[model samples]
Target chain A: MLALAFQLARRDLRSRYLGSFSGGAWALLQPLVQLAVYAFVFGYIFRQRLPGADAPGYVPFLVVVMWPWTAFAEAVSRGTTAIQDNASLIGKVALPRAALVLAPVMASFAIHGIGFLGLLLVMLLAGAGLAPAGLALMLPALALLFLFALGLALLLSALQVFVRDIAPALPQILMLWMFLSPVFYGRYVMPEWVRPWFDLNPMTGFAEYLRYALLNMPAPGLRAMACSVGAVVLVLALGLFAFRRLQRHFEDFL
Target chain B: MSVLVEAHGLGKSYPRVFRRSDRFRSLCSLLAGRASGEVTPVLQGIDLCVPRGQSLGLIGDNGAGKSTLLKLLTGVLTPTHGSVRVNGRVGALLELGAGFHPEYTGRDNIAMAATLQGFSADDLAARLADIVAFADIGRYIDEPVKHYSSGMVVRLGFAIVAATRPDLLITDEVLAVGDESFQKKCIRWMEDYLEQGGTLILVSHSMYHIQKLCRQALWLREGRMQASGDVFEVTQAYLAHHERKSAADEARARDLDAVRGLEFHVRAMRVNGEEAETLPAVEQGAALTVEATIASRDGRVPVVNVGFARADGTPVYGVSSDMDGVQPAPLPDGDFRIVLHIAELPLLPASYTIRVHPLDSEGLRLFDTVERTLTVKGRSSESGLVRLAHVWEHAAPLSRSRGE
Candidate 1:
């Protein structure tokens, strides 16, 4: 099943990159360009810093949260119709349904890799040394990212075959989720009254952990990372559960 | 040895029907009383089983639930009613090129296809070369599949599944693809697989292929099993039923035209053409003759026309009495026999209707009615449209040429 997922993901990657200049390079280019403009406008013009200011530079600050957020959103939207988009295959071939859901997740992971490297370079350029603690946490952070993607991918892709409206509705919904995620600023930047709320949010802990990893910052902590991982598992399980329940009806509806 | 697949009361209903009824009902419920309509059931109570190593052929006319049954068997479309169980893995050519990515190379797609069909990474690695060679697109294997032709796509697709070697192979019309040579190759490969103890379940229109391949055949009518038994018996019955229906149709058509005036007109016809003389029933080649008669009017005269239309309205030739009537004389008062002489009939054994028209000397139409179905019952085109004299020769440069 893993081999199938990767193979399908490779097809998607080839399709998106084959005709463009610097094939496969666009994955990094998109996130890098966005980071550069944000860093210049906010850090240079506004003369601002990270929410904690003590943690890292603004470019890394934005990237740490932006990468995972973008990955989550992309996985949900693309994975939404992953099966229906290949309705012939789903209807004709006997393949593991799980692989179809995970295909987009693999593609998103490709982009996340590029975005992460771009963030690392930007942080170094800003005179922030790489954080050892941040490096140590990259593995867990990646697991969390994949977990969140799997959950949303399964839920959205399965429904996409039936509802169809879900694909068009994703961008608007994901846009709302972006602002709500603390990607632009830090959890500390939010009002103290809502600090507890940000802590509870799955996106908040993820951002803090990623930043803490790259800049050698202090502990983003075991409790926060554990909470995010737990939420990831719960979401994935529920999403897959929903997907299987709806899968049998896909052929008629698709 | 064992039942490989079985379906009990398997059923499926497309949502299009329910959505349609919802519209009618919602209208009534909104404006007045509750509305209702019957939902169309696409499949109902389908029960079938194929034991291990058995080759099953499904035969049905269009819209008889054949495709639906195949879909359910392959697990593409789930049954809305009973559960389905299969003991082993299934490889299917359900929709040709279903998993092919237009932008990916043939090699890449082979790996992806194999994996999707349940092969492991190592398994694909081992079968990679064999898959490419089987596709027969030598140098283009590295190119993106979108650049490949439709035939190439099937070659690659068939190659991939053949390599996967699933426990059961379920194929629809994938065999009816590409050129004749490719079809022969695929059939031979399938036969080899069967010899190796692999199972096959096929749905096709080629009665000859099915009769030869399947020991037993199934006949489906309106989503129900009409017959399931020996291939020869079932297929013959199916053909006979259609033939009978067509014959009855021809009879009704003749009756409809029977209402025309026989006096001073063309009456009933047998062959629609008649030769002045008759020939032997058993001869070197079969000859078709059209015979007809015109009732002479007391004062008025008419020149009639005769012609033949191929099975599909293709006009063969037409002869009119217009040229014969240029002297202002009507056809003979009684009957006239027009014979179309042919040493051999070129058409295969199939049904074709004949046409007879009535006209004047100036080619002005008087009356025309098509009648007489000419059924050419022959095994091959050797009993051809025209008789020909020919010889066969073999030449050798070092020796001499000989003709027979």
Candidate 2:
């Protein structure tokens, strides 16, 4: 099953890279354009800056947060229809069901790799000092973010099969989710009272941790990071549970 | 032979949701562990078994649940009731190019499909050349499957299934497509597969192919078992039933056509002086008699025509009273009765239809027809509609000569 999953994932990644008009260059270009837009709107127009310290310009700052955020959003949206879109496979083939859900998630992760490269380049051009030790921290933060995204993907993909409205409603919801996570601004921008509410969003700790990993910025404290990791584990369990429960009826409905 | 696959009272039912809102509601209700909507049964109480090394054909009309049964056996759909136990690995071609990623190359799709079928990466590598050779798609194997034609897709699909070489091979109408030569190749492969003690469960609408391939057969009608037995017996029975049904339908349609005309009408028909009713069974060399009564408008004798045809609508022979220089005998009520007789029927062993037609006295045009189907019951090695009365005599062989 694992072999098949990797095989399917590799094919999916290569095909998506080749299926579009721009091929793999589109994967690099999309995040680059999005980061530039965020930088212009927030850094130049709104003049937002990191609180009480040296700021690594908004483009590099936004790139750090957007890298993981984009992956999570893409995974969730793509995963929503992973099983439904493969209705032919489900109807005609007997395969490990979880592989369908994982394929899209892993594909999203692969694209994220290209986006991270763009982030690294933007940081280098912005003259952010290279801190190898601090850079190592990105691994744990990125791993946690990947797990959280996969969990959401598993849950949402199963739910979308039963309730089709999830597919159409996902983009707007992700837009709202991006605003709620501090993709454009720092956590300090939120007033103390609203700061508690900000921490309630699991992605806040994630974005803050990723920024800290790359930019030598302030972290979300130990409690927020622990809570985020705990939430990741909890969502992973619930996602798998719901996915296993829903998949048995997938053939009948799909 | 050990049992390869067994299904005891297997069934499946799908909930019918009439409206989009109702579909959402039913889905929610189902997820909530509550009864959803009105259940429509697709298949029910289907009990069957395929022994190892046996070839079983699943024959059915459209909507008779043959596809559903194959799906159940292959574990694509869970049975609603009872259970199915399969003893060995199963490779199926349930649909052409199913599970193929359109954007992936044919070779890539083959690797994925083979791996999903439980072949190791190394196993796929070893068999890659053989699979590519069998598919015979040539350079198209390197192109994405989306660019492949339907036949090409089936070629790649069947090639992969062949490479998997599972213990039990299940296919649903896989032989229906592709060109004649490819279909012949698949049939040849299937023959070899069966010969090597491989179990097969084939589903097809073509009785000829099924009879040629399968040793045992199961016929399904409206999701119920209609017949299950030897291949020849079940296919023959099913075909005979189909022939009678279609003939009746055609007769009804022709009856409407016969009502519109007033000049000539056929009233009754008899075979061998007995009223031609349901299909009557006869043997070779039997004296065949056909009598038909016709009514005319003006007390003039109308030409009567009798014809014979195979049940599949192939014309065998036709003769008219006018052509034979025989006049119809006048009846009491401006009606006429025509009697046609054959001293010895030369038809081979198969179902046949005798058609009676009324025409003008000159036999220049045809008016109406009434048909009766007869089954020639005796068996012979000869084929086709007629049994030619001829003999072969022994001859001595001559020695070969030098270059002419």
Candidate 3:
């Protein structure tokens, strides 16, 4: 099953970029451009600054939080429609059903990894000198973000087969979701009443975890990390249950 | 031989949703413990077993659940009830090129499919050359599958399946496509595969191929098994049923035209001066005659036409009284008797139908028709609908060549 999953992901990655002249370089282009836009709008135009952030500039602060955010958002949004798009393969081949959901997540993870490394290189060249301990802390945060996205994707990909509204409505939902999380703006800027609600959004811990790791900001406390992990586990459990139940009739529906 | 597949009481039903909103409603209701749409039951109560090294043929008309049954056996669609236990690995060609990605080249698609079929990377690398040689779609193997013709796509699909070499192979109507040469190549490969102890379940509409390839046959009609037995017996029964159905249809068409408007009516038809209600048997190349008596409403002489047709409704020959410039003779009873004659009928040993058409004076328009089915019995071992008379001559005497 792992072999098949790897093959499908590799094929998807290759074909995705093969259509353009720049090939795999195009995968890095979109995120880099989006990063530039955020830097211009939030850093220069609005002149935004984090209240308790140890980082000096808004662009680095935003990049630290938004890199992982981009991966999470893209994986969930694209993963929702992954099963529906591969209805042909589902109906024809007897494959491990989870492979379809995991392929998009894995592909997005690779692209995001490259973009994050590029940003880190630029930040180091600009002399931020991010600490090694904080850099090591980013690994666990990355894993949590991946787990959350995979869980959401599995649940939604199965539901999207029956309720097609999920696919079309997800991007709009994710847009609202990104705003609710501490993506461009830090949680410190939110009104105190809304600050607690940010903890309820699982992405809050993921974003803060990244910010603390790369910018030496205040780290997510153990309680907040526990809440996030608890939510991720719950979603993962429910997602697997629903996905396994619904996949039995996938061929009929497809 | 061990049994490779055993399916009992298997069934499949698809819910019919007329609108997109209805599908949504059904999904909502299904979660709420209530059913919402009409269900179409496609197959039910199918019991079948295919043993190792034995080929089974699924023969049926369109919408007879043949394809559905194949899908169930291959586990593409879970059955609604009952059990299906298939032993050993299975390779299926359910729909030609169904799993192929349009944007991917044939070579890339092969690797993907082979991996899905449980081939390790090293194993696939080892067998890749054999698959490419079998497909033989040169140059196009590196091109995207969307650019391939339908035949090329089938070649690539079959090649991948063949590379896996599962214990049992299931195919549904995919052979009907592709050029004759490719089809022959596939058949030869299948024959060799069976010889090497591979089980096969083949679904097709062609009886001749089924009889040649399969040891057992299952005939389905309207989601039910019509017959299951040795290949010869089941196929013969199916063919005989088909013949009876077409003959009834021909009879119905004749009866419908007999009462149409009644400007001209055919009273009686006689074969070889002997009147009969049904078709009469005749020897091949024997003298035959068809005499028809017709009654005209205005006492105007009407043209009578005679036609010969094969049992399958293909027109063989037709000649009208007006076409031959022969005028119908008026009888004393206010009717005309038209006679069509043949010194020697040139039909092969098969059943045929002779039809008569009554037209108004000129054969420009037909008013009524009557027909009789004839069985031409003969000792000649000829094939096809008609037998042409010819003498065989030796190009060079066989004895001279042998002596040399």
Candidate 4:
């Protein structure tokens, strides 16, 4: 099953940029362009910065959170439509159906993860105040974030097979989710009453932890960390349960 | 022999999703672990057991669920009712270019298909040259599958399946698209595969192919098993049903009341003592008695003619009383009765129609006709309408070749 998932992920990645001139380089380049646009809008125009005077630059602060968020958002949006997109394959071939959902998630993470690593290396050399040791320390957090995205992906992809509105509405929902999370700004920028409520949003733990690891910023509270971990475990279990229950009926509806 | 495939009360039904709301409702119910309501059943209650080395043909009309059964057996589609257990690796070529991604090159699709069949990368690499060679599509192997002709698609599809050499092969009418040469190559490969103890399940509209390849056959009609057994019997029965359906359509166009007004018309026609539109099936070489009662509007002698034809309207033989230098015997009620009996009917096993016509005394100017369907039942695989009487000369006995 793992081998099949890898084969499908490779196929998915190759087919995405098959006819393009830049080919796979576009996977990394697209996110770089998005980062440039965000840097211009927030760093230059809005003059967004971290709270403390000793904080790292605005671009690195945004880069750490934005890259992982892009991976999560792309993974969820692409994975949601995986089953519906492969309706012809599911009806004709007998294979592990979950692999279809897993492929897109794996592809998203692989492309964005490589881009994130390369950008961090470049920042470290540019004297952006990023801790070299924190890069090693952040591996566990990155792995956890992958599981969180995968859990949501499995859940949404299964629902998308039956309710097609999920795929079309996913982009708007992810945009709202990103704005609500601490992607563009820190939770400290929000009003005092809402600061504590940020713990409920799983992305809060992720965004704060990435900054804390790489930018030497304040870490997320223990309650927020526990809440995010609990959410991942609960969502993963629900996703697996829903997927296993609904996978067999996919062909009938498709 | 160990069974390679076993299915019991297998069935499938699609949930009715005419409205958008139904899909949502079905999702909710399915998630709640309840059966979705309002389903249209496409197949039901199919029981099959195919032993290793056995070749089975699936014969059915369009929409008869032959493809559905094949999908269930191959584990492509989940059965809604019962279970199917397949104990070996199965290779299936369902419909045209099944499991092929249109945007991918044929070579790429082969790798994907090989992976789906549980072949490791090394296994596919070893057989890659053989697959490309067997397909024989030349440079089209590197072209996108959507750009290839339908015949080329089947060639590539069949070549991959042939290379897999699965323990059980299930194909669904895909061979019909291939050119004759490619088709012959596939059949030759399948024959060799079968000889090596591979099991097969085949679906084809052409009974000739079924009879040539399969030893056992199953007939499905309206999602139900009509008949299953020896290939000859099931295929013959399926063909006969089709023949009767077409004959019935033709029979509806000719009204009996309109024919009664003719100068001389056939009043009744019977085959083998039974007077019905369709008679019971008769064994091959069995005696057949065709009796016809002709009514003459005027008190004049009428000549009777008996003709045998395949149900598709291919005439086999025709004979008239006048040709035999005889006349129909007149009855007291002013009707003429003629009986034509063949000591041994030489017709092969298939559906045939017997036509009785009343003509004037001169054996010309046929007035009216009545037809009855006769089915010949046997295990003979001989081709053509009738069996010819002949002898093989200077032929050695089979035991002599084996030195028994």
Candidate 5:
């Protein structure tokens, strides 16, 4: 599965480059620029104080959260349409359909990793140097992030086969998710009572964990972690079932 | 003997249309707990087996389910009702440049395209040089493919595909991918593939290609296999049906002319000849012999002209007696079947129509007219609208025996 995922990732990146002049450098640059903008706005312009944040500045905090959010957002946005975009491939080849969802996940992961490294630098500049303890959580954090994106990608990609609107609607929804998840504001900033309502977001948990683990603060609430894992499994199981149901019908539609 | 692909009772279907925006509908339905609608059948009960080394031709009209069948047999689509079990590796070119990216360089695209076809980086590493050399667009192999000309794009595509050499190669009409030379190269490559015992199934429109390459042909009509057997047998059926349809159209034109009103006092019309006129047989590519006449209503003019037409009411060509650079002298009264003469008639006959119109003095219409047909029948080298004199040669002669 990983081998296939890598092949599809290579194809996915190549197509992004092929279809546009900027190539994949543009993809890497877009998020980098987004980070810079947020840094300018929050770290310099606003210079808002972090209450318990030995975390240095807010944008680096925002960067860590936004990077993963972008991955999840871009994965579902592009991944749902992956099968639709490669209708020629879907129409002609007998491929393991999971590759469609996995391809975008890998591509998003590659770009997001660059943002992660950039976040590391910004945090260091903002007076928060990495601790060995903070570094240890990276893999688990990435895995949880990966699982969350993969599950949603699979579900939306399958639904896209039957209903194409998922491909376009995802980005708008992702933007909505960004504001809701604490990319610009922490979930803790919400009231104690409404915080539970915000915890319904699997991503709210993942982003809070990035803030906590990377900044020497507390991780996302335990309930959010539990719910996020459940959401991944649920999305994956239901996505596969929908994919299996729609798999036989795709050629005719193409 | 190698058996590369087998499909038994394979089928697939799709709903005629879900609204293009059905994603929103599906989301709405999902949130509301409703199931999606049922599917409509597209392919029903198809059984086909392609042995190694044989090229199978699939010919059908649009919507005959040819593309759908190719998808099912190649495993791009699973059968809704049955099974498809393929042996060894399979390559399907259901569409050319299936996963190509416009922004990527040719080399990068090739690497990515091969990987999508289940190739590993190592596999591509081994074949990369050969694929590049085969594509033959120097220097531009590293440039983005969007800059490549259409012809160049096809070269890159065919290069990657030809390098694969799978156990089974299933291709749609996408082989019409390049120029004539490339098309010929593709066919030659397929012939060589067959020579080496690779199995190939091709869906094509060219009867010439089907006859030359396929030992057997499957004819599909409206999504069901109409006939499957020797290539010659099935092609003959397709051609015969086409001829019958055109003939019925010719018969309808003849009946319409019987009721046309012309200013001339009386008579009938037709092109070259059908029910009313016949000419002496001439060599192929000779001018047509013509015949049509009009009786005088009041001796206004002796102007007569005949038009040659195809079965569908289209004129083949026309000429008139009035063009001596001036109208023919006015006619005196006499009932006449005008025998307009030509030295040669250049037509390959299935059926032809001649519309005979009568003009009065000053080239004005005042009375009656007619449209008719000319049916030419005989075994001739010429089969379409035009006839040609051609050469025939035989390499060997065989003796015939009375007893089997």
Candidate 6:
């Protein structure tokens, strides 16, 4: 099953940019361009600043959280349509159906993860006040974020096969979710009452952990960590349950 | 012998989704772990057991659920009732392109298909050259699959399946798309595969191919198994049904009341002591006696002609009483009776019709005709409408094979 998933992911990645002139380079460049646009809008136009004089520049703060968020959002959105997109394949070939959903999530993470690593290396060399050791420290947090995205992906993709409303509505939902979390700004800037509530959104722990690890910022509270971990476990359980239950009937509906 | 495929009471049905709301309703029902409310059953109660090394042909008309059964056996569609158990690796070519991606090159799709068949990268690398050679599509291997002709697609699909060398091969009328040479190559390969104890399930409209490749056959009609047995019997029955169906369509156009007004018309005809329009199936080479009575309105003698034709209206032979220098015996009511008897019927096992026409005494002006359907039943695989008398001379026949 794992080998099948890997093969499908490779195919998905290659076919996505198959006809393009730049080919796979666009996987990294697209994220970079998105980052540049966000940087210009927030860093230059809005002049957004992090709290405290010692806090990292707004661009670095956004950079740390933005890439992981992009990976998560893209993984979920693409994965949601995975089963529907491969309706032809599912009806014709008898293989593990979950591998179809897993492929897109794996491809999204692989592409954005590389872009994130390259940008971090460039920043470290530019003397951007990044904790070089924190790069190593963030590996565990990154792994958890991947599971979180995968959990949601499995759930949404299965639902998309039946409902079909999930895919079209997912972008708006992710945008609202990003705003609710601390992707563009720090939880510290929110009012105190709302700051504590940020713990409920799973992305909060992921964003704050990246900032704390790479930018030498404050760590997420123990309650926030527990909440995010709990959410991931719960979502993973629900997602697996829903996906396994619905996978058998996918061909009938499709 | 070990059984390679077993299916019991297997059936399939599609959810009835006439409206958008029905799809939603079905989704809700399915998610709730309940059966959908409405469905159109396409197949039902199909029981099959194919032992290892057996080649079974699936023969049926269009929309008779042959393709659906193939998909069910291949595990592409889950059975709605009972179960199917296949104890070996199965490779299926269910449709034209075998589910290939149109945008991908043939080489790329080959790799993906091989992976789907559970071949590791190392295994595929070893067989890559063999697959390309078997497909024999030349430079089109590098072109996108959508750009390839339909025949080329089947060639590539069959080549990959051949490379896999699965334990059980299931194909659905895909060979009809290929050109003659490619088709011959596929048949040769399949024959070699079957020779090595491989199991096969084939679907084709061509009975010649079915009889040539399969030893056992199953005939499906309107989603039900019409007959299942030795290849010759089932295929011959399927063909006879079609022939009778077409002949009946033409028979409906001729009204008996209209023919009764003619000056010389056929009054009654009987085949082998049966007077019905469709006589019971007779064994090949059995004696056949055709008797006809013609009515003449002016008390004049009439010529009786007996003609044999395949049910599809292909005339086989015709003989007139006048041509043989014989006259029909006159009855008390001025009608004439003639009997034509064949001591050993030469007709092969298929559906045929015997027509008796009444003509004026000169045998030139035909008045009316009547046809009776005859079905010859046997296990013979001989081709053509009639068997010819021949003898083999100076033939060597002393060799014996170990398996036999």
DockQ numbers for every candidate? 0.29, 0.44, 0.38, 0.76, 0.29, 0.62
lDDT of 5 by residue, A135-232 (tens): 56766877877877777777777667766566777778888877777677766666789888776887777777777777665777788888777787
Residue B210 of model 2, lDDT score: 85
Candidate 4 per-residue lDDT, tens place, A30-92, comes to 988998887777666666453531234878988999999999899888888989999989888
Q: How far does residue B84 in candidate 2 sit from its true spot (Å)?
A: 2.6
- Select the stronger candidate by DockQ from 3 and 4: 4
Summarize candidate 2's per-residue lDDT along A97-119 as a digit string, tens digits.
88888888888887886678656
Model 5 lDDT on a 0 to 1 scale? 0.69
Error of 3 at A57 (Å): 3.6
* Top candidate, metric DockQ: 4
Calculate the i-RMS of every candidate, to one decimal place. 7.7, 1.7, 2.2, 0.8, 4.2, 1.6
Q: Where's the lowest-lDDT run of ten residues in candidate 5 chain B?
A: B252-261
Question: What tens-digit string does per-residue lDDT give for candidate 3 at A99-134?
Answer: 989988888887888888887877877787565566
State each model's CA lDDT, in order.
0.68, 0.81, 0.82, 0.90, 0.69, 0.88
lDDT of 4 by residue, B1-404 (tens): 99999999999999989999999999999999999899999999999999999999999989999999999998889999999999999999997888898988999999999999999999999999999999999999999999999999999999999999999999999899998888899888888888788889999999988998899999998999999999998999889888777766656456778887888988888888898787999999999999999999997999999999888777999999999999989999999998999999999999998988899988879988788888899988889988999999999767422111
For candidate 1, the TM-score is 0.71
Better of 4 and 5 by DockQ: 4
Query: lDDT by residue for model 1 over A8-51, one digit each (tens)?
Result: 88777877876688887788787778777767666666554544
lDDT of 6 by residue, B310-360 (tens): 988889999999999998899887788989999999999999989999889
lDDT of 1 at B293: 54
Shift in Å, residue A26, candidate 5: 5.5
* CAPRI tier for the interface of model 1: acceptable
* Model 6 reproduced share of reference interface contacts: 0.57
| Error of model 4, residue B169, in angstroms | 1.2
Displacement of the residue B279 alpha carbon in candidate 4, Å: 3.5
- Give the per-residue lDDT of model 2 (tens digit) for B185-217: 998898888888888999998877887778889
TM per candidate: 0.71, 0.78, 0.78, 0.91, 0.70, 0.92
Instruction: Give one digit per residue, the lDDT tens place, for model 1 in B124-170.
Output: 88999888888888888999888998788888888887888877887
